[model samples]
Target chain A: MKILVCLGNVPDTTTKIRFDGEMKNLATEGVQWVINPWDELALTRALEIKEGSGGKIEKVSVVNVGKADAEPTIRKALAIGADDAYRIDADPSDAYFIAAQIAEVVKNNNFEIIFAGKESSDFNGSAVGSMLAEFLDIPSVSAVSAFDFPDGKVVLKRDIDGGKETIGIDTPFVTIVQKGISINPRIPAMRGIMMARTKPINVSQPVAVDTLVEYETFELPEAKAECKMVDPENTDALVDLLHNEAKVI
Target chain B: MDFELTEEQLMMKQAARDFAERELLPDVIERDAEARFPVRQVKMLAELGFFGISVDPQYGGSGMDALSYVLALEEIAKIDSATAVILAVHNSLVAYGIETYGNEDQKQKFLPELASGNKIGAFLLSEPEAGSDATSQKTTAEDKGDYYLLNGTKNWITSADNAGIYLVIAQTDPDKKHKGINAFIVDRHSEGISLGPHEEKMGMRSSDTHSVMFTDVKVPKENRIGEDGFGFKFAMKLLDGGRIGIAAQAIGIAGGAFDRAVQYSKERKAFGTEIANHQAVAFKLADMAVKLENGRNLVYKCATLKDQKKDFSTLSAMAKQYCADSAMEITTEAVQIHGGYGYVKEYHVERLMREAKVTQIYEGTSEIQKIVISRSLLKD
Candidate 1:
C-alpha cells in the first residue's frame, strides 16, 4: 500500500506576525517557516501505520503545493522517514488551488491512502483535505483523533458532537488529521537528514483551478484596555464601579 | 568564505535543538539536584545517531563533518552541558582516537558498537599526578606473552561508571618518558577493574564522574591503539580535537545563560520599567552577545579547519582558551544581571555559571592552552 501525506508550510507559531504594503501580503523579513504542526502529526501517523503494518505498507510519500522556498520544509518531512516527495511547483494561493493540485498528484500516483492536516496554522482554513477528497471522488474523514489498522482495514475515531465515533473506511481514502492522532511529531535524526539529501524529490506543474474567494482587507484585533485600580478603603465606590462602570456583578 | 551551514547541518542543528528542548530540558534541573545520570536520554541520543555524529558511515556513524558535530553539540550543551560532555568525550576523544589511529580489525570490532551506542566509550588520560602535564603518567601496562597487565588509577573520568570500553594511556617503558606511553583499549568489565564512588561535583552533576582503578587488569595485545610509544602523540592529537568540542560546549553554556538574562531583563521590572530599558543591563546584554559571537566564530573556524584537514593545533588551543574564558565571564554576568534570582537553582543561570568554570579547567586548563599557543607561535 502506498500512502501520500500532504504537507503545508506555515510560519513558526512563535514568529512575530507582521504585514506589508497595506496588509496585502505577509512580510517575509525575519520569519522562519516550519511544517504545519497538524500536518507533521499526520506525517507521523502515516509513518506509524507504515511501521505497524507487517510489510503491507510499501511506500510513504509526501506531496506539497508550494514554491521553491518550501523545499526545506519538504526535505524535513522526508528526513522524518518519507520514502519520496512530490513538489507541485506553484504558489499555494487558496485552499481550492492547493487541493486541486494535490488531487491531480493523487490521481496520477494512485496512492491507496492520503493524509493531511485538518488546517494550516497560518490560515486555519480546514478545507483543503476534504476538498481534495471531493476532487479525487474518494472517501475522506476529517478531525481524525485516533486511528488503527486491524485485519488490513482502516479504522478511525473522530470527535462527534460530544463524544468520539469510530468508523471503518476502505482503501483509497483521505484523512484530515488533528491532535491526538499522534502524541508527538518525530524530529529528524542526523542520519536521516543525511540520507534525505540523496532521496528523490520530484517536482511537477500545478493543475489549474478556479479560486472562489479573495481577501479584501486585513486588520489587527483591537488593543485591550488597561485594568483600573480600586481603592481598598471605599467598598461602596468599588461596588458602584463594578455595578455601573465595569458592568460586573 | 561562506559561513552559512549546509542544509544537512541545519537539519542536524534543528534535530538536536528539538531533542534537547523536549527531552533534556524537562528533567534537567531535577537531575542536577539529584546528581542523576541521564541514562534514558543518552540511550535516546544514541538511537538518534548522536554518538557517531562525525564518524564514518561505514562504521555505523552519520559521517557528518566536524562543523556539523559542533553545531549539534552546541544545541545539546545549551540545555544540558553534562549530556553534551558525554557526547563530546565519546565522539571527539575516544571514538575519534580509535578511528584515526586504530587498525582495521580494531575499528571493525569497536567502532560499530561505539557509534551505534550499544556500548559507551571513555577516554582515560588524567591521573592523580598528571592533570595538565599529561605525560607524567603513573599508569603502567606490563608486556606479557599474549596480553598486557594494566595497573593504574584514572581520576576525573567522565562516564566511568557506565562506559563499556576505555581507551587508557599507560607507561610501557619508563626510560622513554613520554615516548614510553602506549594507548590500550580495555574492557570495563575486566577483572581487577574497579570504580570509586561518583564525585560530588559543583556542576555538571548529572554526568557520572568517577575515579577508575585498574589492578592487574588484562588487556589483549590486539587492543593497542597504534604503534608502541605512540600514546603521547595520540593523546595530544585527541586533545586538540577535544578542545573544539569544549569550545562549542562553552559557547552553548554562555548562549543559554545570555538568553535567560535577556528574557529576564525584559520581564523583570525595576524603577517602574523593565530592567532591559536601563542602559546598565542593556550594555551587559550587548557585551554578552559580542562574547558569544566571538566564541562561536572561533569554534566554527577551528571545526572548519579540522574538517579541511589543516594544521589547527594553535587555533584549537586559542579557541578553547578564549571560548572557555568567555563562558565563565558571560555566565557570571548573567547571574549578576539576575541579581538574587540568578543565585538560585530554579532560575538555571546559577547552574550554567557553575558549569562554565569546568570548561576553563578541563581538556586542558586555560593556562595550558596559552602554553600550547605561545610555544607554537615562538617556535623557530
Candidate 2:
C-alpha cells in the first residue's frame, strides 16, 4: 500500500501577519514559510504507520499545490521521511483548485490511502480533503483523531459529543486528520535532511480549474484588553470590580 | 559577501529550535536545580545527529557546515547551557580535532564512534597547576618502546566519568618544554584510572565536571595524535575552532536573556504602565539587543571564516571575548528587568545569569582571549 499526504504551505505560526495596501492580499515581504502544523502532524502519523507496517506499506509520499516558492517546504516534508513529493506548479488559488490538482496526481498514481489535515492552518477552510475525495469518487473519513492499521484492518476513532466513535474501513480512501493524529511533528533527522537533498520532487504543471472563491479585503482583530490585577489582600474590591465592571457576578 | 543564511541553514535552525523548545525547555529548570546531567536529552540529540553537526558523513557525522553547527548549538544553548557545552566540547574539540589532524587509522578507529555519539569524548588538557598558562608539565607519558605509561591528574574535565574516550595531553620529553608535549587518545576504562566526585558549581551545574586521575595506564604507540611533540600545537589549533563554538554558545545565552528581558518588560507593569515604557528599563533592553546582535554577528563571521578555510584564530578570540562579556552583561540586565521575579529560579534569568558567568571563564578565559588578540596584533 502506498500512502499520499497533502501538505499546505503556510506562514510560521509566530509570524505577525499583515495585508497589502489594498488589504486584499497578504504582504509577502519578510514572511517565513513553513508546512501547516496540522498537515505536518498528518505526515508524521503517515510516516509512523509506514514504519510500523513491516514492509506492508510500500512508500509514503506528499503532494503540494503551490508555486516554486513552496519547494523548500516540500523538501522539508521529504526530510521528515517522505519517500518523495509532488509539487503542482501553480498557485494554491482556492480549495477546489488545490483539490483538483491533487486529484490529477491521485488519478495518475494508484494510492491506497490519502491523508490531509482537517484544515489548513492558514485558511482553515477544512474543505480540501472531502473535496478531493469527491473528485475521485472515494470515501473520506473526517475528524479522525486516532487511526491504526492492525493486521491489515483499518481502525479509526473520532471524538463525538462527549464520547468516542470507532470505525473500520477499507483502502483507497481519504482521512481528514485532526489533533491526536500524532503527538508532535517530527524534527527532520540529520541523515534524513542530507538524503532529502537527493530525493526526487516530481514537479508537474497544474491542470486548468475555475476559481470557486474570492475575497475583497481583510480586517485585523481588535486588540486584547489589558489585564487588571487586584491586590491579594482586597477580596472585596475584586468582587466589587467583578460585579460592577466585568458583570460576571 | 552575502549575509543571509542559506535556506538549508534556516531549516536546520528551525529544526533545532523546535526540538529544544519541545524537549529541553520544560525540565531545564528542574535539572539545573538538582544539578542532574541531561543524559536523556543527550541521547535524543545523538539520535537526531546533533552531536556531530560538522563531521563528514563517512565518519557517522551529520555532514553539515559550520554555520549549521553554530545555529543549532546556539538554539540548544538558549534552552540548556550545560547540554550545549557538552555538544560544543564533543564536536568542536574532540571529534573535529581527530578528523582534522589524526592519521587515517585514528580517524577510522574513533571518528565513527565519537561522531555517532555512541562513545562520548573528553579533552583533558588542564591539570591542577595549569590552565590559561597551558604549558606547565604536571602529567607525563613515559615512552616505553612499544607503548606509553601515562600518569596525569586533569582538573575541571567535562564528562570525565561518563566519557568513553579521552584525548589526554601529557609531557613526553621534559627537556623540550611545551614542544615536548604530546596528545594521546586513550580508553577511559583502561587500567588505573579514577575520577573525583563532581564539582559543586555555581553555573552550568547540570553538566558533570570532575578531576580525572590516571596512574600507570598503558596506551598503544598508535594512540598518539600527530607527530611527537605536536600535542601543544594541536591543542592550540583545535582551541581556535572550540572558541568559535563557545562564542556561538555565548551569543545564545545573551540572546536568550535579551528575549526574556524584552518580553518581561512589555508584560510587567510599573506606575500603571508597562515597564517597557519607562526609560530606565527600556534602555537596558535596548542595550541588550545591541550587544546580542553584535556578538551574534562576530560569532557568525568566525563560523563563516572557518567554513571558508580561512585563518580565523584572531577573530575567534575576539568573538569569544566579546560574546562572553556581552552575555554576562545581558543576563545581568535581564535579571534587572525582571525585578523581584528575576532573583528567584523560576523566572530563569537568575539561572541564565549564573550560566553566563562560566562562558567568560571556560575553554579560554576572557583574559586569555585578550592576550591572544593582542599577541596577534603585535606580531611583527
Q: Candidates' interface RMSDs, in order? A: 0.7, 0.9
Per-residue lDDT tens digits for candidate 1, residues A70-99, read 999999999999999999999898899999
Question: In every candidate, what fraction of the native interface contacts is reproduced?
Answer: 0.77, 0.58
- For DockQ, the strongest prediction is 1
Model 2 lDDT per residue over B80-143, tens place: 8888888898999999999999999999999998978888889999989999888996899999
In model 2, pairs of residues that clash are none
Q: How far is candidate 2 from the true structure (C-alpha RMSD, Å)?
A: 1.8
* Runs with alpha carbons beyond 4 Å of true place in candidate 1: A223-249
Clashes of 2: 0
Tens-digit lDDT string for candidate 1 (B1-380): 99889988889998999999999999999999999999999999999999998889999999999999999889988899999999999999989999999999999999999999988889999999999999899999998979889998999999998899899999998899999999999888999999999999989999999999999999999998888899999999999999999999999999999999999999898998899999999999999999999999999999999999998999999999999999999999999999999999989999999999999999999999999999999999
Q: What is the TM-score of chain B in candidate 1?
A: 0.99
Tell me how far candidate 1 lies from the true structure as C-alpha RMSD in angstroms: 1.6
TM-score of 2: 0.97
Inter-residue clash pairs, candidate 1: none
